[model samples]
Target chain A: MNLALRDIRHHLGRFLLTAVGLGLLLGVVLSMIGIYRGLVADALGLVRAPAAEVWVVETGTRGPFAEGSRIPGDTRESIARLAGVTETGSMTFQSLEATHRDRKLRLQVVGYEPGRLGGPPAIAEGRGLARSRFEIVADVKTGLVVGERIPLGGDVFTVVGTTRGAVSSGGDPVVWMALRDSQVLQFRLSPAPARREAARGPVAAGAPDTINAVVARVAPGASVEAVVEAAKRWKHLAAMTQDDQETILTRSVVEKARQQIGLFTTVLLTVSTVIIALIIYTMTMDKIREIATLKLIGAPDGRIVGLIVQQALALGLIGFSVGASLIASAKDFFPRRVVMLPEDAASLGLVVIVVCLVASGLGVRLALRVDPATALGG
Target chain B: MTGDNPRPLVECRGLAKHYGEGETRVDALRTVDLDLWPGEVVGLLGPSGSGKTTLLNLIGCIVEPSAGTLRLDGETVWEGKWLRPDLRRLRLEKVGFIFQFHNLLPFLDVSENVALVLDMAGAATTDAFARAHELLDYLEVGHRKAAKPSSLSGGEAQRVAIARALANRPRIILADEPTAALDGERAGIVMDLLRKVAVEQSATVVVVTHDEKILGRFDRLFHLRDGRIEDMASRPGDLTG
Candidate 1:
């Protein structure tokens, strides 16, 4: 037992090299796990921001992103009159591509009234949107810092504040602006379309005076389900709890992205397992003659197996530690938030250990098959 | 020579081993009988393909014989079936083997390589290290205990192997051309060390060698030819005949 560990310590350089290789592979696995968690966090951030108990959207629609949701802007006024309706605010959602500093950036525009029920909850830098029409608060992911001017439709809005992790279900950075700007950005007609509309004279854009959806807060001890049921009685509207809205966003808007990430994670894990197995197998093969000699000299089978397994586990632990540290330090450099939770790291560590043990099986078989007589022969 | 002791340390009766079957079968050992007692150093002199290694391997319990009865320290080790399922444990507790190449683990230092055998046999760390140091001192290699095998000369490495063999104080020691890789002076030193250890420990030592220069040191000698024992001499200086 002492001899095994002494031998490994004596050959520290080789072991460290093997461990480093394993560590890099483990880093990729950890990063994949973190990215998946980050996706879920990003999707939930928007719903969590409002601090609203229930949501009102068009009937049979998933949410503001997945399906077209349009209800009269005044629907909030009606919902506010209901029992247990503490407060209500109208909000609009749209994804737009705009130019900033010769670069085209895509953003999910969230429009709301300042100091209202639904708005940018917290600012990481500078002030929140103070003016009603031209000021905007942007997520840092949009690469727009404070005072940076970005064109939305035909108007240029100065970035008044920067927030973190404010992304839509599709991972687009969320930019908060005044409700009128969002409505105009989403529904405003181009010059030619405006001319055509003017020529048509009396043609009315359906629900021309309405905003997209109403977000509402319920009073204490009020049943959200009752309010949602009452809102559904309107012919063109539906109401949902905050949890239901999150489910809609996850299942409808980000389903494909989630599947893509899931497939990628599976592939990376398989590759990591195979890589670890090959390395352990190769190391064992290099020591075949030595193993045979050890067995011939009266070393027990358990000791031999222990040596191999110890080496494998050492490799995994060292690699995982290095990989975990690397991912934690480098996560912020990534384009998306890599949420490395302790539970995720703990589970990944266990998986790496299992991978190492399974990988050592090949080497164990090779070792057990060695004939002690070979040590006696030429 | 007959003594009051009922069993020799090692005894083989009509041991036969054949490789392959039918027309292609070749006899590696054929009906050989031998007895080795404690405090005796014997030399096996043979040409190539003369079953010297095969006989050594059988005595070392590395391979099974087709037909034979082997007794070690009054216990029947191999008859119709193996007396012990743990052959490795048997080897560790009762026998020591030295090969032509020093065969020291390159990753281990001199003392560690020697102590490894005792450690494998479940000896305590301090006891194993003390025994290893004692053996190294006996072989006059104690000063180089911390050096790796790769850093040692041919003679020093072989001495380490000898100390390793004696670490467990086995009843029988099998040396297969242990001095084959050394020059005349180093080979003589290794042979003298083997003789001294054998006499001091009262353990049986068997050396299989093609070297004729050091044949005079053994208490007995056997000459093998074509997988059969041809001659057995009781006197060491009788090789002139």
Candidate 2:
């Protein structure tokens, strides 16, 4: 039998307990990695589904997620007139909370034309939006089913269909409605404010035609960069390629969460390395007599080092395996999506193995320093 | 003791060891000289603090002599240049060591403990275990070959240790108080086994001990007092001739 397995079998309880403890800690680290991935995925899911090669927003703004964009609704018409522009759709997004089933349900209300790029790519249940007003397509997470009616902004809208994985950058489920109806809900004032506005004289009610941004899809053999450059010439418009939108979403919208997760992952890795080193050192200290005897009996230094290193590697492998399994199962309980990609687990496993090798250094040093003379004692 | 020239298996000339420096300098060994023949048992007898174990350690090559030349089978194995890796390999291939405690790996069974020597010697697993079984049977612990060190009685454990030491079939065995923890009967039995091993294996055996009960069992005795040999006398007469 190999020395590592033999040693573990000799102290089965202690070895298993240590491995379980380390595995739990590694599970948290793995979850953090998945959570970060989930944040990026959720942030980009809405931005990418439209299949628009470029987005047009107000100048001096990163995107709708980073800063409010108040581009004129007519910007879509101006952008469509450009060469190689296959389709252009004006869309608006706003976070709204509605009481449904006596529960506060938060959602991102998306305003888009019925037949356009910004509509739901696929519906999970029922039919997508078919009417022009008072009809909605909701994400499955919105907890609303087909044919359900919910009071939203001076109107009770019916949920006509349900879409999966369609969430805003902030993880709010999305609801799709006709552009004109969304404009009324977003820009129209309450009845009391409207009466006060009438007394102040005839004035526009927040300009119902204003939109958040316009998305454009390029024709075949057309360059997204060329379209972006053309759209940028409109002094009041800020145009970005899909890559630019993803960067803004990742580096700004979810930037703080990413940094926090990054810091946590680093701290967890450091703690794991230190804990492994300490465990290995303690084990080596306990076996000083056996090691000295082995040395005195003429076992080579390499063999001694191999014994210590093999045990460390075994510990890391077992711990990481437990951690990965935990993440694979526990992800279902997470409210936000937990995306544990196969490559992520594999990469973390490799890192843990490297950490195991480095952590074995302390134990190897102790084993080597064990005077063989100690075995020939007085 | 020196005899007709097959050459001594172990020879030490002016072997000395000192620890610390300057004002704290303490000599652990001082100007010791000795020769051991093949197929002989040498009892190293000394009072507490007489440096019997120190001398044992020097001969075992666990401690380098401060000043001396140590020759094993007429080849220089120790000088000042122990930093060279060849010395360690020489010790591994040419010497076996036993401690007062059995010191067998607690995780390993008796047979595997014995087979470890062959493993270190790069023997194949089948051959190593076969030789280990043969040695265990020869040592009379073959019945307990599958038992862990923790389960064995003191005598059984020590016998297994002897089997382990003999696994590589080295030319010399250095044992330190191999029977210190055993009672008179077991002690005598262990001493007899050492004597038997020397005769049957044609290997030089040096045992360090203060057990007066087994004194008569040695072919020769070397008494130590204050890091120096006081006497080298043959037991009975002209033994191992």
Candidate 3:
């Protein structure tokens, strides 16, 4: 009779209805996992944008995101001079606002040398920083069009090229300009500081040579850790390999929030486990008479157990399929991007298989306890 | 095949079953003796609470007797509330049962319901279905082989049940009120079908019933009263159509 399939066929509406309900709960759990992935992707995008093999910052601090790191702008020259260093650039990051009519745009301004490693990694349209000081290459997220003019800090720059997914770890669209111009913009003193510098007269009319951090790429086959150690020897500086920076960004920067969301996902999955167990147990209970009859007819114990386990797994698989579809379709509706990987789905399937087997335990116990004589009745 | 040493298909001596412990213990069956030979169909008659079903259950190996012995097809299967260790194997290989309800698995078609017995007995799929089809054809329900139990008429469903009981080609068929829910005509059809399967398949058949109308079909009738067989009558297929 293929008992499991038969039972499902006999009660398909009820089975599908329960699966949908379970699927929604599972969908919420899968969504939580997707949000975690998005958080990592967004956080790492900026760190990965430079593709720098090593970073040099102020000594004893984690990195730019976790702490302030200011080194002399001229340090890029020294870093590039190192034996195995292939390329070098000094960069600055700061949040700035520009008013275009009544709509204000918030962006993270990035200053990088032209024709160097620190510029926008890829261009989606137009070109990269065609003119230097007055031209800007912007992320598509900025809602600006090619050749458009936007005024920022008393100077209007032309948008020459566009990039996709070029945002800061904090999700602000990135705006690229020449390193020198960024230095001038970022190092601008507040009125009080400018007044204090003015008191010292023309001696300080020119800004100091300073930058947030220096980024470097190591030669192919050269160890980045060795380069970092060489840079860190400069007593006034600290250096981190790319992997260290990734850790600091995801672990130090986003770990706490990720863990929080991860906790909710775990809770939801636990609830799913219990709910599946209950549904299977209830289904088994409803068919107690049939089970007893089968037992009385001398069906083997393994056969009975197989029926319960198979039904439980069928329920789990259908629920997961529905939940995965729901998460995939609804991802765009979420505020943050939701990344669902195929590997993650495969991994979740393994876990659900185990959960289903464990869930069937309750039903198997109750079924085995049934007296076959019950089929004869009182 | 009829010789002095021809083995009995089923034999029970002083078979007893009791329920409860201490002061509340009661005997559901007590010290009953009986014998069933191959190709014999027996009917057990009794009123409510007379332990007719209890004796049938013991004979079918679904329950253990509290006292005495049971041998099936020349093998001693029970002694004093203890059943043989291989009881499940014996039951699967040698026993068939029909209940008051048709009890065909509702999700399966008539053929699958019949084939399930051989499947459980570890028969190959093609062989199981082939035998199932043969049985349904013999029972005159071949046209309904693909119909699920829920859609089948009463007579058709019971006949399918009869087909299932005969699926494993068991040595004995124990039917408890097989016609309980059927009209007279349908009951007569089921009884006739069961007798035909019993004799043609060469299995001893035991029926426990309160219905007097179908009494004429049995080769021998045992009347159970207060856990004892009160009478044994031999008259074969008097109601056979």
Candidate 4:
């Protein structure tokens, strides 16, 4: 008979209750990992959507995703003229909050030329931008459907399409509009500012034709590295290949968040280990007398150690299962996308098993020290 | 009548136990020479701190002897140092212990408590349970075999503890105050049961107690005071050495 199981069965209610409390703690750890993964996925979504081979931004700037970058809208034409460049599109990004249906909606507005290479990767509903001036393609997460009119910059735009998983680095859903329309909204001055500008000096002739970055696709037989080097030849423009852009975004934009989450996870696991050790130690102390009795009866030390280890393993595994299940069923309810992969759960399960083994050490040591002669005393 | 056997089941010569050193030294058991034969029920009567329990611990091979040669079931188990490399295995194979309060594991049912000893002895699971049931039946507590120790009455628990001690059919059974918690009638009944077990199994039974009410049950009694055997008494009709 497994003495550990027999003892747990005798105290089934209390054991399960303890496991549930432990499960909740483990659940927080799992969520931290999922949130970290979601942050990376969200950070990379917009960068990967356009599928550009090369990016050209203002000189000395990392890229639009890492920091502010601006270049003449005509930079698209200059990049398209490079030897290996096949297509080029100008793109702009701005984050804004707007009231729609009396509910506050936060969105990342993306500006890309409609017929170029930088539109939404795929349209999940309705159609792409047919009329550029006031048509927008919204991400499904934005809670907008086709034909819904939303006001931005004192102008209303009709939702023409919807996309999935299209979000900004900060986890806000994205919406796409025509390049010219975004330029107008981004550069247009309000009446009061325009009047003040006129009183000081003559206002600029027309809206500023500036875009955040220019993206290029290389021809199949052409070298993307060669195109990037050629683009860098322009003194006012900085160039990067798609891989370089992704690396900068992940390394510079989200590195701190990753480190913070990793630290929190380590602390939580340490706390888990300590808690389990104390609990097992207490449980062992409670049965010191019984252990002495068993020893007096000539029980092998292996049996006593096995009892403690098996119970620790059971508690850890049951707690892990409960935490995993709770997270799996509730991930969608979180404000940020909580991404859970199969390997994540498997890895955490392995860690929990090791933790339990390590935690049972204190109990095992205490049990082995008990003097069997004590049982023969009063 | 059984004294004619060629050898005693337990033999001790110049056995002694001491604690600490120098100014703080204490002797738990003074040098003693003793022999207990099979099929005999003996008692060690003493006051608190008189070392009755210490002597029992030494005889059970749990405590290290300061200066002594000890043998159980014809095998020298300890002599200043352990003669056998594994004293636990020796005890498992040759000796049994019963405690004052029964000490039945609360988590295990009465039957499992008895069967645990057989299990530790490497008996097959089915065979161990069968032997546990047989012992419980022999002890007349078979009806309470399925109940947990917590639910059983004190007398019933003690009977289960006895069944556990006898599970391996050990040659030497050392019980410390086996009936210390029992009433007059129950104490007498338990003593009779121990005597019956000793005679039928041909085992040596040694009990340590201060209860004089059951004094008549032991075939022979040793009075231990200040760690020495001060006197020995053999009841009428019992063989004396």
Candidate 5:
């Protein structure tokens, strides 16, 4: 009705205030949904970005998270000689604590051959690691810029490039280093331990050195499942397709984080719904006497309901706009990535509207029960 | 005695209204009857809780009487049951109501508040606003059209309420203590405005009030006491006697 809109415009300040409050709640919900999607994306990005089709690891162990698996680094040479094996590269994975800009940060160090199967896919700033030993490509979340020196394993390594969204399943930022550096970080023992081992026996000289996981690419037209099964016959190792590796990573590494975020999201949604309901109820109560007057004057029940719903919708819309803007500006400032996808925002807007409508039921009931006769008396 | 001359704009016979039941029962109005014709202003004089409001509510179709027949413009609106289920439509199309407090929606400006009834009656938005503006111009409150109710004086607010009542061009307008909140001068001004609107629009107007000073302005007067119309007078001097 024209009258209702006019009333809302006339009281635009209060209406806007209410809407802004609702928008903030909607924005938070949207960001939460986006973060969940980002988590899945981050976990799959490293595996999916590589063109590899099959992974060879120790038998009966989920490498990269569940257990450590080290095999002879030269296994790649043997795997490359096998039928249907197009290309193969050995990679080492280890988690390390490093100091960047005087801040202690945990990083997942990945070692791979330069310009080979395993490496940083894309660089957002600077250039990808060019040298083999001392250069590193770190995720931008580490706050390390190009030319910055990071202290890791009692040595300073220069940051050559920065990548975006390259985080491990545990949310630790990933850093790509030379294979030798990764192996040293993973297998190098302290002097006390190395000397202690040497003292225990006459260590075999020229023995084969072991490294973690061999990532391989299958020849075009080769069935990945068949190649994986063929590689499984080796008693000392297991083979997995890219998809299976992703599932293992999610289940083994990020399951607890997912559960924690999911619980937080549910709690936030509940709080948002309750906030909307309370606001609608309060606004409706403020107009009870006026509603009775309208009813007494023969305004139809539908008209009354329409007015309340319109106000509720307006509040939700306003709140969502404010909340979305706030989240967009503040998301990156959070310690974790707060992904704000467009579809997620759109869905959140719909949720806000639905919550507003559902929230208005309490006020509508109160309004319908208002006795029109109350408007007649003093 | 109904003919082509058109019955009184409002007619109530043996109208009775009771509240509660059994031991706690109270009679707010008992066996009251009154008539209001077009182009006339009638005053209902009574003290507080004397059934003046009850009679107004009954005529306004807001409250149904326990026993009575009410006719408006020669149409029987109530007998044992409400003749029309959509009383809201009946009110919007046939009757107008004014209250002492003005009761203009505070969130809406003066013009929008006046136009609300016409908008509810399905009039186009432009047409509703135009009618509201025209009525405000008639009542001389057009200058304050864009102002909210709180910004206006008591007299201006009451005038806006009157304009709203007349926006739908109803056949009858019911004013319950319309001047109860104003001073003597403002009350007289409001009463005079009501009289002018009723006569000019050719609509019946009923003013329920305890203000004895404005008794002489009405074409007819009725005295309500103890929930019944005990005294009726065609002239102001009948009460003094």
Candidate 6:
């Protein structure tokens, strides 16, 4: 008879309840890992969606997402004229909160020219922006469908298409609009500011044609490095290859959040180890007399140690399974994206096993110290 | 029947056990010489702090004797120091112990409690369980074989404990106050079972007890006082002061 299994079976209710409590704790640990991955994924989503080989922004800026980077809208033409640059699209980025159906919708607005390199990654519903001024392609996370009209800066734009999983680094859904409309909404002064400007003197007829950055695609078998170098010569702009932009976003944009989550994960695992040790210690204390009797009956110390270790392992594995299940079932309900990968779960399982082995040391120590003579005493 | 085989089954010479040192020193068992033959039931009587349990512990190989030459079944297990490399296996294969509390693992059923001993001795699961059932049947607890220790009456639990002690068919059976909590009738039945075990299995049985009710049931008795054997009786109730 396996004593550990028999003991657990005898106390099945309490054991299962303990496992569930541990499982909930483990679930939080797993969620932290998922959230970290989601943060990286969300941070890189808008950068990757353009599918461009190079990005041209204001001098000294990492990219449009990391900080403010504005170049003239005509920077696209300069990038397009460069050798190996197959296509270029000037795009602007800004976050806006608009009220639709009396519900406030937070969105990351991307302004790109029609039939350009910058557009929604894929159209899950409706169609892409076909008009030059008012049509919009919005991500489904914004809760907007095709044909919904929302006002932006004194003008209303109609949503002509919908996309999915296109969110900004901050987790707001994205909306694509015509470059001219975005320029008017973003750069055009409000009525008060415009009137104030008018009072000073006759102002320019329109807002300056400024865009956050220009995205350019290099031709097949072309050297993207060559185009980047050429854009750098402009003195007014800085350029980066696609790989560099992704590195900047992951390493610099979300680095602090990742570190914070990692620290929390470490602390939670430490807490789990302590909890497991205390639990195993208490369980062993409960059976100290039985252990003495076992020793008196000629049971080797190995058998007693095996009993404690087996129970600890069982507790950890059961708790891990419960936590993984809970997180997988509830991930979609979280406000932020939670991306759980198979390897992550497997790695955490291995860590839990090691933690259990280490945690059972306390119980093993107490058991080994019990004197068999105690069994013969009153 | 006690000395029919001529050779002693257990021998102890100059055996001693002590605790602490110097000013704090306490001798639990003093130098002693003894012999026990096969198929004999011996009883050890002592008051509290008489070192009866300490002697049992040394004989059972669960405690190391301070100084001694001790042999069980003609094998010298302790000579000044332990001669046996694996005392646990020696205890498992050669000696069985019954405690006052029955000490059946509460999580295990009566049969499993018995089978655990055979399992520790490296017996196959099916055979160990089969032997457990057989021993439980012999002890008249076969109907309660599936019952947990907590569910059984005191008498039934002691019977299960006896079955467990006999599981490996050990040559030496040591009982420490096995009937301390039993009524006179129940205690007599337990003594009768131990006597039967010695005669039928040809095992040397040593029982440590403070109860006088079962004194006349032993084939020989040793009265211990102040860490020494104060008296020895060759027959039931026979002693030399």
Q: Which stretches of model 1 miss by more than 4 angstroms?
A: A189-207, B1-4, B237-240
lDDT of 4 by residue, B136-171 (tens): 998789999999999988788888998899999998
Q: Candidate 3 — which pairs collide? A: none
lDDT of 6: 0.89
What is candidate 6's lDDT per residue for A1-378, written digit by digit as tens?
Answer: 799999999899999999999999999999999999898888898999999999999999997889988788789999999999899999999888888889998889999998898888899999998878888999988888899898877789898999988899899999999888877767643367754553464223365577899999988999999999999999999999999999999999899999999999999999999999999999999998899989878899999999999999999999999999999999999989999999999999999999999999999999999998777655
Give the TM-score of each candidate: 0.95, 0.94, 0.89, 0.94, 0.92, 0.95
Q: Which digits, one per residue and each the tens of the lDDT, describe model 6 over residues B1-241? A: 5556877888989899999999999999999888988988999888888988888888898889999789999989998889988887898899999888888898998899999999998899999999999988888889998899999998888888888888998889999888887899988988898888888778999999877888888888988899999888877656523
Worst 10 residues of 5 chain A by lDDT: A199-208
Candidate 5 C-alpha lDDT tens digits along A127-184: 9778878889999888888998877776578999999888876678989998777766
Task: Report chain B TM per candidate.
Answer: 0.94, 0.92, 0.90, 0.94, 0.93, 0.95
- Cα lDDT of model 2 by residue, B1-241, tens digit: 3444479999999998899999999887889989899889998887887878898888878888899888888788777756446555777788888788888999888999999889888899999999999988977889999999999998889889988888898888988888877889988888888887787777899998877777788888888888899878786233212
- Clash number for each model: 0, 0, 0, 0, 4, 0
The stretch of ten residues in a row with the least summed lDDT in candidate 2 chain B is B232-241
Fnat by candidate, in order: 0.71, 0.61, 0.47, 0.69, 0.71, 0.67
All models: lDDT? Answer: 0.83, 0.86, 0.84, 0.89, 0.81, 0.89
lDDT per residue (tens digit) for residues B16-126 in model 1: 788999999999999999999888899998888999888988888888888989888778889977887988988898898898887888878999899999888888989
| Top candidate when judged by DockQ against the true structure | 4
Instruction: Report the CAPRI category for model 6.
Output: medium
CAPRI-style quality class for the chain A–B interface of candidate 2? medium
> What's the DockQ of model 2?
0.62
Q: What overall lDDT, based on C-alpha atoms, would model 3 receive against the true structure?
A: 0.84
Instruction: Provide DockQ values for all models, in the order shown.
Output: 0.71, 0.62, 0.49, 0.74, 0.67, 0.73
TM-score, structure 3 vs. true: 0.89
Model 6 chain B lDDT-worst window of ten: B232-241
Q: After superposition, how far is residue A104 of candidate 1 from its true place, in Å?
A: 1.7
